[model samples]
Structures are given as C-alpha cells and as structure tokens.
Target: MDLTHSAQDEAFRREVRDWLETHLSGDFAGVRGLGGSGREHEAYDERLAWDRHLAAHGWTCIGWPEEYGGRGLNAARQVIFHEEYARADGPGRVNHLGEELLGPTLIAFGTPEQRDRFLPGIRTVEELWCQGYSEPDAGSDLAAVKTRARLEPVSEPGGPRQWVVHGQKVWTSLAHLADWCFAVVRTDPASTRHAGLSYLLIPMHQEGVEVRPIQQLTGTSEFNEVFFDGARTDASMVVGAPGDGWKVAMGTLGYERGVSTIGQQIRFARELDAVVALARHNGTIDDPAVQDRVTRARMGLEVLRLNALRMLTGPASATPGHEVAIGKLLWSTWHRSLGELAMEVAGAASLTAHAPPYELDDFQRLFLFSRADTLYGGSNEIQRNIIAERVLGLPREPKP
Candidate 1:
C-alpha cells in the first residue's frame, strides 16, 4: 500500500485537526487524554459529552455508510480521521462499543428494522452500549459461553415475544453506564459449543439485570460483573439469525479490530513518548539497556502500524483472519513491556504512591494497568492458538 496520502486526504486531515483544536478547548479543554483503558473512569460524564459533541458535528462513525447516519468515509479518509483524532489527544471515546463494534455488525448482519432501531442511537451517541461477550468461564474461549436466552411470550396480550436471558457476564466494560448490552447466549440448549449461541440485544436498566462494578488494581471500575436473573429483549432483537450468533459475534470481534486501531496506535505512540521522556528525566536514557528497550519499543510500534494498515487493506470481511490475532498479540505484548519499561525508568520511586488515598502517578498507572494488557482482549496464548490453527493449518487442539 502507498504510504503517501493524496492532496485531498491531507486536506481532510487538516480539517479534522482544525476541528479538534478548536472544539477540544474551553469546556472540553481539560478532557484531552482522559478516559482510556485502565483510566476509563476519569471525567466520564464530560467525556460522554465530548463524544456527543463529535456526533453532533458529524464526526462520529465516519466509516459507516451515509444512509446509516455516518460520513461514509472511505478507508483512507477513515484512517485520516482516526489519526487526527489521536494527534489532537481527543478524549477516549465512550461510545466505541456502539460505533465501532456493534454498529458495523448490525449493518452487516441486522435486519432493516434492527438497523433503524439501533443505528441512529449509536450514531447520535444518545444511547451507550456495553459488550456481553466474556463470562466467568468463557473469557478467551468465547465459544464456550453458557449464557442462555430463551424466547417466551410477553405477559401483555398480543405483545411481542421476549428473549429472557439468564446468566452472568464478567469483565463487562462500562456496563454501569450503558443502556444496552449485546450478548451471546445459548438459545438452543440441545446444541453445544458455538452452535447453540445467539447474539441478543439486552436492555440494561430492567429489574432482572444487575451491573456490579469490579474495582481494578488501578482503583477504578471500568469493567463490571453483570448478572441477569431474567433479563429480556424483544425476540426480534437478535442480530442475524438466532442460532447464527457465532457468526455475528465473530463479526463484532472483527470490527473490534478495525480502522479505529490506527488511532489506537497513535495513542500508544504517545504513551511510548511519555515513557521515553520519563527515562530522560530520571537519567535512565543514558543507560544502554534502557535506551535499547526504548528503541525496540519504537520499532515494535512501527511494525504494529504497518501490520494494522496491511490488515485494513485486505478484503473487508466480518470474519477476521489470523492477521487480527497477530496484531492483538503484537500490541498487547509491546504495551505490557512498555509498562515494565516505565517502572524501570522510574527506578525505586515506582514503589510508592504519589499521594494520599492511593493516588498513582501516570507512570505508575501505566505500569499497573498494563499488567492486564495481555490478559484481557484475548490472552497471548489464545492469539497464538488462532495463528497456529487458522494460519498455519495445524491440527486443532483436543477438546477435553
């Protein structure tokens, strides 16, 4: 792929940059670089307002089709938008589950009615969403999900049938703040593994549903444990066909690794720059080992960007191939290593908190939170398994 941008692309980039510079000031000025990964709890309401600000100006979902209430930006322009957003240190998006993952999945697999019902909410940032993919036993082994949702008649006469979901989902990011959850549930009890699963759109505010925040080592509750006693959605709320959830869920995962990753790498670049600056301040930059690690981190980031671009240029499919797994493995490992590097640069000071009430400095937060980088979003082992089985055409792992 050509690395150089066309004049038009450059012009679009400038437009995005100017808009961010102008708007990410005044009331939104303090929100830059707030809310991301382990730090998602920061300025959440304000960040949400910032997200709406982007949506109001027609900046959200730039890659969705124009009819779906997006800018309908092509691949190049989408990349430009994300890159510029990160360059301006835009607040971490609170609506990504809606915009990046679920919206695209719906567009690809949803019925027209489903699209009309959900797309506008996502595009306008009026309703927030959380993913219900991971469970206590099914984190990386997504196909092993045991959450069951069975359709039953509504109590009101002639009302629509409802999917009564009963199970628990752990590591549900931002569930407390979301209005809805797209969950993978076992709709067919007789079926096993990936066969019986269905992707159901569940409402979060109902009495049968409960969201309990899980405080992390970072002293924040960005993730939650969501319990569903008898949570429900309209029977028609399932994306794609009922038993075809394995396909829809995988498609959402593909979207999870989509064009927005370019922006993510830009953020990672910023984090790396901070680490290097810290090293310089602490005189660790003069140490050959620290300098070597920093240089390696820089090279790894470049490689990650190139790989992501390569993936973007490939055929647009909901089912991501081994390349996605490779990218996941690359970035997660690199980020975890960068965190360790941050601590090494901080020297002994990393051992202590910066203030009372257990306030951690930026470097400390980076180090502590990044320990889970390889754990969540598919462990390194899982990624390797994907590469081995799918890409290398190796024998499947034995089912125990």
Candidate 2:
C-alpha cells in the first residue's frame, strides 16, 4: 500500500517535521499538556491555543479537503503529522468535537449552507462542539435515546414550532466550552430502535439549554449533565433528513473512532517510551525479568503504531470494523501494563506522583485513565464481539 513515502512525500514529511519542531518548541512551558495532568486549573485556552496555532498555518485540518481549509495531504502526510506532533509534545487540539465528529459528518451529509456555516469555524477553532448522544437511560444502548424533537410552526407565540426539544443528556464532554452540540433526538418514539431519530445541531448557550459539569473521582469537571427544556432550534439544524439520523450519526461515530484516533495513538506510543525510560533509570532494568518486560512493552508499542498506520492507509470510510476493534483493545491492554511497569520502576515515588528522585509526576494519572480505556469508546467486550462475529466469522453465542 505504498507505506514507503515517495520522494515528494518524504520532502513533505521533512517540511512538516521542521515546521512543528520550530513552532512547537520543546518543554510546554505554559501549555500544561493534555487532560490536566494533575496540575493547575487547566487554563481552558491551553488546548484552544494549540488548535488555533495549527489552523492559522492551515495545519490543523491537514487531511481535510482544500475547499474546506486543509492541505488535502495524502495518508502518508497524515501519518507524518501525527508522528511529528507527538515528537514535539504538542498540546491536544480543542476543536476535537467539531473536527473529529461533527465536521466530517457535515462534509459527508451536510447541505452547502451547513458546510459553509460550520466548517470554517471548525477550522479556526471559532465554533466548538460536543456530542449529545448519551442520555440518562441510553448510555451504551445509544438507540434508546428518549430526547424528543417535534416539528412546530415558526410563529406559535410561545410553543416552539421550528423544533421543540425536550430531553436530558448526561456525560456530555466539553459541553460548557462548546458553541454547539450535535444531538440525537427521537422524532418518532413509536418507531423501532435506530429509526425515527433526528440529528440536530443545538446551540449550547440558548435559553432552554443547561450545562452542569459532572465531577469525577479525579476532581475534574470534564463531563457534564446537559438538560434541554423547550429548546427551540430551526428545522435547518437537522443533520441530513429527519428519519435518516441513524445513518448520519453512523458517519459521525465513524470519524470519532477513526480520524480522531490518529493523534491519540501516537500520544500513547510516547507514553510507552516514558515507561521504558523510567524502568531503565530506576535500576529495575538490571534484573533480567524486568528487562524482558521493558522489551516486551516496546515491541507492543511498535505493533500498535504500525497497525494503526496500516488501517489508516486501507480505507477512507471509517466503520468500527475488526481492525479498529483489535487496535483499540491492544492499545488499552498494553497501555495498562506499561503503566504498571512504570509503577514498579518508581516504587514508593510512583504512589506520591513521582517527585524528586522520580521524574514526571503524571504517570500514575495516566495509569488511572488507561484503566478506563477499555471501558470508554465502546468496551473491550464489545470489541471482542465485533472481532469474533465480523472479523472471524465465528458463530454467535447462543441467546437465552
């Protein structure tokens, strides 16, 4: 699949690496890094700054079509971008909800007006978006969403005729900081699951919308409980046709599981290197068993990076197929093991956030997040099922 870059691709890679190295200088200083690594108040713009910086140079949406503020680079360039960004320790892009989930869906299904309205903002980090799929009752069973969106007349005096939304959404990430949210609302509850749903882009700060952050064990308010009461949106806000929401939403999830993954997969590869460095410095490498563990971890990281690259090259369509399932599952399992290795390396220092004698204090926090890796973004169990039924063509487990 031409994994080896052509001369032009090589030149492009060199150019990107040089640009990123020069602009994103080492030691993040004010950056504070990704996901609040157990430090300060998160300085909201730290993430935003990174996205804007990338957009300003037209580097943020590298793989996007040139018509929509992108370089239209090839898959190889995309891989180079991910690799260089991680090498530079670049901060996470804040436009993720827009770029990763909403923007791509718009490109595939949106009207010209929809694309014109949202894509430019997404490029410049002007409009932020959050997903509103999960609800109080429909956490993993996404088709069970009860949020209702009824059509109405534009001039009802009090009643919303455009689209009156009445429902609750929980565990919405970045809801407070977002400009909009792409929600799945039930237009016809009587219809069977995965039918009669409408995908609507709701303005987050409007009158009927309420966003209250949900605190986690980490003492952070990253996720929120969002409620909508009489939330009125224009009929134009519906993504694709009313009853075709399930299909449109499938497009959204596609980008979420695939495109958004490029940067993150590289980031975790760097984490494995950190684990190896810790093991080497902590004197544990002197023990052959620990040395073998470090070697195994390194091999696992390389396999993940290579496999992700192979997947990216094969398809433009982003379905949650067996390859993605296997990649995610391996990443989660290997990541947790690396975290445990780091703990062993740091010993008592690891428990206390790795200070003085120990290096960076964030490994433990990463370890905690890894524990949830298998749980979030569709659990490992679900991935196993996909691999079994879809990839292996195995017989389904007998139903009760």
Candidate 3:
C-alpha cells in the first residue's frame, strides 16, 4: 500500500544491504527456491545455517508475530524486506511448507499446544513439513482424494485420539527429509466430495509409511511418492476438525497460491539479472530486438512482484478468482519467455563449457522447469474458468 518507503524502512533496507554485501558474492545465485534441487549436502547445510542466522536476526518469518520468533513487521515492511533482500541478492530457501502453510494454519486454526509445539521448531528448521495433498488420482480435482483415515479412540488414560490412515500420496516434496506431512484423507465417503474429509499430520519415518523418491527430469530427487499402508497418528495431529479437511486444505492452498509463491517474484528478478548479464556479455544487448526483449523481461519481473504482493494483501475469499488467474498466466508466460530469451542471447556459446556464469545451463534448467509453472498451482485453464464464471460472470460449461 505504501508505494514509497519511510526513513525507517530505508534505514532497515540499508542495514540488510550492508549485511548481504559482506555475506553474499557476485555469483551468489542458488536454487532460487526449494524444488527438486540436487543433493548438495554443503548447500543444504549452509542454507540451514543461514536460516538460523536470519531467524536469530529477526529476519526470518517476516509476517509472524514477535512471539513466534519474528520481527512482527507489517506487510509493507515485509515487502521492503523482500525487496531489499532481492536487491542485495540474498533470499533464502528455508522451509516454505512450515513458514507459509503450517505456521499460518497453526496461527489461525491450531490449538495453543500445537502452536507452542510446532512454531518454534519451524523457526529453527528442526521440524520440516511437506504437503500430502495430491494423491494418485487427485491433482486439480483435490476433493477427489482417496487417502483414508479412520479415527480410533485411545484407550490409555490421557492418551490422544488415534487415526489409522492408508493411501498413496504423490508429488510430496521433501517427504524424505520431512518429519511430518499435513495431508487430506477421506474420513467418510458417503458424505460427499467436499465433506467427510479430514486433515492429519502423518509421521514420515514411521513403519507403515514408505517413501520413494520421484526422479525428476532434472535428474534431482526432490519429490516423492509416499505410501501409507496403515499410518497411525494421534488425534492431536488433526489440523482443524473432523470432516473439516477440505476447509483446512483450502487454507493451505490459499497459502500456496497467495503467499507460498511470493518468494518467486524477487527470485525471478534475480534470474532476470542473470539473463540480462548473459545477453550483454555475449554482445546481444546491442541488438535492438534483444534489448527490447530484455527490457520487457525486466518489466514483467517488476509486474510479478507487484501482482504477488497484491494477491498476498487480498483476502482469502478473493482466492484464485479471475484476476488472480490473469496474474498467474502472465507470470507463467513471462517466465518461459525469459528463459527462451536467455537461450537466444547465449546462442551457440551456451553450448560451450566455458560460457559465462550467467550463460550456463541455468536457463536450460529454468526452461525445463518453466514448462510446468502454468500447469502447477492449478492449471492455467482452471484459472481461466474461474475468471470466466466468477470474475466475468460468464455462463458455466455444460455438465458432461
């Protein structure tokens, strides 16, 4: 909302800038955000260290209350923090599922016991989490999830309610490293697609649960196919309430769409810098067409930041409505286009092992990954349908 930073914000920005200058380097690029990144133990270890350092400095979990080991900053300050971090080329890949999804869910819907138990560890990156939303069949049609959890009453004195779960979850990111996964499991089939579901925190390393990595086209094993033959969890792990899984999962999706992807805008900006540098170094910047494309990419990156901020500031009820769809489509298209331009700018030189740092296979990596952006977080087609029916008030398609 505040387009211009106040003096305090400017000073805070400078403080961040000074720290980054000492910490990061000219080639300080990393896996912009968490994905199926290569297993670099050193990178992971360094990232964990950075998260702890940032958390100690009140820079991690920017939106959380001070009680939860955050700075209690306003959304404006949060934006400034992201902007400053980006400018200094120092963003982190620290525990998105925890900070963005579970942390907020705990803040809004979790009991005090859950919050006190979970929030602090998330800050410390001690308890990692992954989403167990997608199933063998349910992707966009998430309400069609078949993972089943049957509630069992605990017999021991003061023991928790227990749930025995059985189902398969696919595309669960970091399930191998995660201690817990927040999942939507079918509790009652007779209730309906949207009802009779429940959210549960299933332990990953338990005996009945088996996790196999999903080897990505990128040759990295970041996602997994997890099977729960008879995974049992205490009743305390249910997120919201029994049969409230759809609602609780909606909260997660809301976090995913609006805030989870919030880190990408600036990271893309940094990527844009690399692309532009590659173009300039390869003597393509002087080409009028190349310059035009580069400038457009820069503008698109800026627009992405503003759009993501707008989405974050808006209400949960606003959701993935038409306006949100438009933003996403534009972001997805521009993302691919930027990668294309990077390849073009690099030309045959990109084929050389001695290509400039920015001209390396980064664009190729992104190009492959970019193909999936529009498809994930709900397909662009789904977003368009939402826009038509909700934003444009268009008639719905006929039922088959």
Candidate 4:
C-alpha cells in the first residue's frame, strides 16, 4: 500500500488539524487530553459533550458510508483525521465501541433492517455501546461462552416477539454507560463449542438487566459486570442468522483493530515522550539501563506503527484473519513494558498514592492499569496461539 500522501490527503489533514485547533479551545480546552485508558473517568461529561459536538459536525464515524450518516472517507483520509486528532490531544472518544467495532460489523454482516435501525444513533452519538464478549468463564476462550438467549414465542395473534437473555458478562468496558450491548450467547441448548452461538443486540435500560461497575487497578470502574435476567430485545435483533454468531463475532473482532489504531499509536508516542521527560527531570536518564530501555521502547513503537499499517492495507471492510493477532500481541506486550519502565523511572516514589483514598499520579496509574493491557482484548497467550496455529500454519495446541 502506498504510504505517500497526495495533495488531497494533505489538504484533508489541514482541514482536520484546523478544525480541531478551532473547536478544541475555550469551552472545550479543559477536555483536551482529559480521557484515555486509565483516565477515562476524567471530565467524562465534558468529553461526552465534546463527542456530540464532533458528531454534529460530521466528524464522528468518518469512515462509514455517507448513506449511513458518515463522511465516507477513504482509508488515507481516515488515518489523517485520527493522526490529527491525536496530534491535537483531542479527548478520548466516548463511542469507540459503537462507531469503530459494532458499526463496521453491522455494516458487514447485519441485515439492512439492522443498519436502518442502528446506524443513525451510532452516527449521532445518541447511543453508546459496550462489547459483551467476555464472561467470567469465557474471556479468551470465547467459544466456551455459557450465556443463553432464547426467543420468546408470540403470545397472541400478531403480538411482538423478543429474545430473552439470561447470563452474566464480566469486564464489559463502558457497560455502565452503554444504552445497548451486542453479545454472543448460546442460542441452541445442545450445541457445544463454537456452534449454536448467536450474536444478539440487547438493550441495557430494561429492568431485567443490571450493571455493576468493577473498580480496576487504576481505581476506576470503566469495566463492569453486566447481568441479563430475562432481558428482551426484538426477536429480529440478532446480527446474523441464529447459531451463526461465531462468525459474526469473529467479524467484529476483525474490526476491533482498525483505522483508529493510528490514533492509538500516536497516543503511545505521547506516553513514551512523557516517560522520557520524567526520566530527564529525575536524572534517571543518566542510567545506562534507563537509556537502553527508552531506546528500545522507541523502536518497538515504530514496529507497532508499521505493523498496523500493514494490517490495514486491505479494504476497509475486510475481515482480517488470525494475522491481526500479531498486532494485538505486539502492542499489548509493548504497552505493559512501558508501564513497568514508567514505574522504574519514578524510583521509589512509585510505591505510594499521590493523595488520600488511593489517588495515583499519572505514571502510577499507567503502571497499574497497563498490567491488564496484555490480559484483556485477547491475552498474550491467546494471541500467540492464534499466530502459531492460524498464521504460521502450525498444529493447534492440545485441548484437555
């Protein structure tokens, strides 16, 4: 794929840069750099308002097709937008689950009715979404999911039908704030493993559903335990045919690492810069070990960027295969190491909270929260399994 920017691409970059510079001032200035991985709880309301502000200006979901209320930008322009957004230190997006992951999945695998019903809300940031993939028993072993969803029979002539869901999902990011959840549940009671699973879109506001926040190592509750007790959505809400959820779910995973990754890499660059700056300020830069680690971090980040570009070289809508696991493994391991490096740079001061009630400084929180970086999304072990068994065409690991 051509990495060179054409005149048009450069012009688009200027447009994104100018727009962010103009709008991310005055009222929006406080939100600049306010929310990210460990800091998502910071200025949330302000950042949400800023998200809606972007949606109103046709800035959200720019890569989506125009008919779906997007700008229908090509991949190059989309990268430019994310790059500029990160460069300007724009606040972390509130609707990434909706806009980046689910939106694309629906576009690729969902029925036309699904698109017509859901795309507008996602485009406008009127609805927020949370992934419902991980469960207490089935985090990386997704096919082992035990959550069950059964279609309710029509009670009377022409009465509305719905699917009743019952199960618990753990580590549901942003579940407390989401209006909807796209989940994988067992639609067939007898079918085992990857078969008989269906991807269902369930509403979060119903009485049958409950959300309990899980406070993390960062002292924040961005993740949650979601309990669905007879929760109902329209019978037609399943993304693909029932018992075909494994495929649709995999498609969503493919979209998980998409164009927004460019912005993420940019954020990582900023974090590395902060670590280096801290090392300098505290004289840790004088340590040969510190200098070497920092240098290695920089190199790993470049490798990350190049790998991301390679992963994204295909059509925007393509469903990536196991090759994408390589990217996940690399970024997660690199980030976790950066967190450790951060604590080292702080010397002994890293051991304590900055204030009462577990207030951690930036590096402390980074160190704490990033410990899960390798665990969530997909575990490092899981990624390696994918790379080995699928990408490298090696034999599968022995199953007990």
Task: List, residue by residue over 1-400, the lDDT tens digit for candidate 2.
Answer: 4557789877887888888767765433456355532222365666677678778888877778889877777667777777777667766666777876788789889999999998999989988999999888887667888999888888867655588899999988888888899999999868768999989999988899999987654456677899999998888999899988888886676567664456666777677677767777777778888888888987887787777777777655444445777887887788778778877877787666345543345677676656666766557777787789988999986755
Error of 4 at 246 (Å): 0.7
Give the number of the best model, judged by lDDT: 4
Rank candidates, lDDT, best first: 4, 1, 2, 3
lDDT winner between 2 and 3, please give it: 2
Scored by TM-score, the top model is: 4
Which 10 consecutive positions of candidate 2 have the poorest summed lDDT? 32-41
Q: RMSD, each candidate, Å?
A: 1.4, 3.4, 4.1, 1.1
- Name the TM-score of candidate 4: 0.98
Model 1's lDDT to the true fold? Answer: 0.90
Model 1 clash tally, residue pairs: 0
The residue-by-residue lDDT of candidate 4 on 1-400, one tens digit each, is 6789999899889999999999999999999998888888999899999999999998999989887878899888888999999999999999999999999999889999999999999988999999999999999999999999887765864788889999999999999899999999999999999999999999999989999999888889999999999899899999999999999998888888777988999999999999999999999999999999999999999999889888888866668777788888999999999999999999999998899889999889888988999999889999999888887889999988
Q: Clashing pairs in model 2?
A: 152-161, 153-161
Model 3 spans with C-alpha error above 4 angstroms: 22-42, 154-160, 259-263, 283-292, 312-326, 348-360
10: Cα error in model 2, Å: 1.6
Instruction: Score each candidate by Cα lDDT.
Output: 0.90, 0.76, 0.74, 0.92
The true-structure Cα RMSD of candidate 4 reads 1.1
True-structure lDDT of candidate 4: 0.92
Q: Over the stretch 133-172, how does candidate 3's per-residue lDDT look in tens digits?
A: 8877887678889989886767775656689999999888
As a whole number from 0 to 100, the lDDT of residue 28 in candidate 2 is: 38
Where's the lowest-lDDT run of ten residues in candidate 4?
151-160
